[model samples]
Target: MTLGTHGEAGLERGRVDLQRYGHALMGTYGEPMRVLARGEGSWVWDADGNRYLDLLGGIAVNALGHAHPAWVAAIAHQAATLAQASNFFATEPQIRLAERLLELAHAPHGSRVFLCNSGTEANEAAFKMARKTGKRTVIALEGGFHGRSMGALSMTHKDAIRAPFAPLLDTVVFVPRDDEAALRAAATEHAADLAAIIVEPIQGESGVRPLAQGFLAAARELTRRYDALLIMDEVQTGVARTGAWFAHQLYGIQPDVMTLAKGLGGGFPVGAVLAFGERVGSLLAKGDHGTTFGGNALAAAAANATLDVIEAEHLLDHAKAVGEHLRAGLEALDGVVEVRGAGLMLGVGLAAPVSAQVAQAAVAAGFIVNPPSPDTIRLVPALTLTTAEADLFIAWMAEHGTRITTEGTTA
Candidate 1:
């Protein structure tokens, strides 16, 4: 596993050369660990001949896990059948996915979907649909990460992330997440000038923070009273990740528009904006907005397969059981202050800012956890993660907690 050498047969020789070639080729991501050679189920192998159980699950993208037979077959079949068709022509997968989305939405009637390429694109499309209401203002929750695109960035809460992209789309106000008063005042005051109120049922990138039950309902009611659209960005919490078709369903709230991505296509790129009823659905007309790669045959086929697997496998119930076990174990950690979120989208809050060190230890221990903040460690594992895998992560957390505490004390 030397940094500059190649490996033997079937061993991912690219691991060593990847760092060198990657430095000269790609941007921003830097050198990835072990040059991930292959993956199956909930495990991945790096170039150095190391295998690890994937607790992070590609940031919650690989719902059915790596190299699921169904997904592989679907993609290969679709590739052989039809990979891409210009938006001018209709495709079966696209139509099927659209129908499935509406059924998942369970909207009254006449709900429509606008397909796209990523979570950012989904949010951008939602922003476009919100704008079409002839209003320009939006109220977003603090500590929420929507996407990096202009419109999505505008709704993002972190100052550091937003300051770099200064002079972003204006009229987007951010209020503390789970703070009902601030949301109520802002939405009511600027009701007429507001286009929509965007909120994530469980804030993903800022750490897995779920909005308070009453708080989300208030947003819905406020949007209704102010005649503003309510947008639920489920990019990180949809598609059985939270043991539901969508996270908002847990709170019994219905959003006017719902944006989805992340796990939607398992691993393939796919995004969508679901608008309920005529008032919101008709906002975008022909030629109003579109993406060249949006709803392409390949992405649609992948998404359809992903949905079918979720349904046939009953992964939602599995997620609920495993998530509960994971959360209980995490909450039992000594220095752990609290455990938040539901289903597989769980976050652990530490007594101090040791999450980075804890995450490093977890990496060494073969688990991948995201430290979204100094004190918040988020875990969004694949939906198909087995009970054994869940228990292993719990054990890892207990050991890592002790390691982190000892290191902190010694420091």
Candidate 2:
């Protein structure tokens, strides 16, 4: 069960028993990676005894990487002291975490924080708030992924993901991404009835694609002009993943509502929606939204510690430096077509659809990367990633690039 004890050993054992004993488990994620036993810093040891530099960082959630001293200590201290009390009582960590989030968000006057357990729940809460204003229509972008919940899925882009659950909530319109003209048309066309315009500053689940900075600015402008709220989904791009507190900051835009998760808790489960301006915050009254484990003491403590370390260690600047190194190295490779993203959230475009093969080669070479799409490899390493580790990964890619291209299919 420990690292180095088995190479491809427990993998077989786990696979067999998982098939037998875990039959009740759904096949949603297609039987996750053999099994990850332990992680330290940016490395994870798999059940097969393979140690890999985790470039994905739990899909941008592990901003501090795995088992960070501060995060671990904070969670342990909070758990031993006061884990959870019912919502009837307030906690210091929760209040502090809320204040910290407001500071990062630069929330407008009358802003309020609504905490939750996951990105889906955050979006679900956002939807209810929008609904309370008696508005039924929402404007979403193509390739945007809100969540899997009924309300959130209605705003997601892909049809294959939504078709099975036919007749999803009505009045959700999907527009092409980064098209200012199209956005203008949609907003003008729906102005009379639209409630909110929801978008991700950088689309992570859709393969690390970034929206044009001006496009985001335009969304803010249009939403304001139309008397609709601008909802920025920062679940994967917030918490310094994009070299900023939130990706929208790069464009100098302030959204009315911002949803955050992933890195907010380092690795702990926490999600929240920061509603700005007096009007939007008050829309969700006492009975409008609630969650059981949203603001528990332990989760808040972890989040507080994560934010403290991010600022104390200046991880935002570190993410920018290391991410630039990684991106530049990938772009220099002979077969790479393009590199896209900001900070640690990166996507590599290959001339061919060999990204999956390249990912396997990377693992063999003692690195872990994610092939979000056949031709795109996404690297969302910890914000605290060091230059040496980044260079090591770059060197591995330089050596294997040609092999991956020659042995695999072209896009």
Candidate 3:
């Protein structure tokens, strides 16, 4: 519904729903934000009938954007045909999606893929696989966010959360993000006991900072030196978010193991871990690990359909072109410290700690944006976003950026 017919009533109803949501739901995320009702393309309509240009793209999950025909059709068709089955049974879409990912990743012929429900679960599976290697220690970068589950949380290097879950397995080492010296020292210090070294091609949560090519190469070298697995956590940067099927494509360096999610199933919940080459691929035998609803038919079909749309529509090239436009425009703005990232995944750095205010003002002005930190605004808009739409947000930033930043805001 647009704003014309149901403006005030819809908003009131939405507020009521939010109140109900507060009492009925757990308070993990605190109060409700927006009672988003529906979406299409790069726009979403709230229950209040207000419209928003969705620049956040549901935190990089909606690769194809809202209500894409192909995405809807795939899920509907799969649900009508065969929605799910036991792990004991295999489905066509599940197998096809797995094969397609391996092919896109350019993994070896016999490489393996493990499917799960979300990025965290994918990381959990990767963590279990790392443990199976018999090495007691694993190294991960600081500011890296894997997931919230116990094991994934251990790998996640957040002091605020990690402190609460202290004295974890103590098997994971945290290296400063993008610190070449720290990485080398950690790798050297724990080289013998290292099971795997997990790094994000682009740090998503802490900030949208892409790891340097040389740093990625160094991590690969360190892993190889200790005979440890190099695992790339491309959960946020994979599935064409970074102008490539995988962000690792930009580096031209391959990891022995890779975790992917976010856009894997477009809007559906699906995650995967692909183990490259023969030896690592064969690590998880029959009963060694399992998933009940990881690669169910519906989610797999959605993923397969998302892949087809990405290729057929040539969104990758579109992302590159439009991303340049967005970045250049944002960088030209006052107070914009820098803009970093490839394709639709971009982080806008500000001179002061005003990202939260910027994001709030953007949303209030009818745009959806995110503050990853006090100083960085993240934009992971839908790949389907048009250059015109990007220009619209750019104009908004140019006009309101300074004023919006000075005001402490929330959306």
Clashing pairs in 3: none
The full ranking of all candidates by TM-score, starting with the best, is 3, 2, 1
For every candidate, C-alpha RMSD to the true structure in Å = 3.3, 2.7, 2.3
Q: Across residues 53-96, which tens digit of lDDT does each residue of candidate 3 receive?
A: 99999999999999999899989998999998978899999999
> Runs in model 3 with CA error above 4 Å?
1-10, 406-411
**Candidate 2 residue 28 C-alpha distance from true site, Å:** 1.0
* Predicted structure 2: lDDT: 0.86
Off by over 4 Å in 1: 1-15, 406-411
Using lDDT, rank the candidates from best to worst: 3, 2, 1
TM-score of each: 0.94, 0.95, 0.96
- Scored by lDDT, the top model is 3
**Candidate 3 lDDT score at position 48:** 76
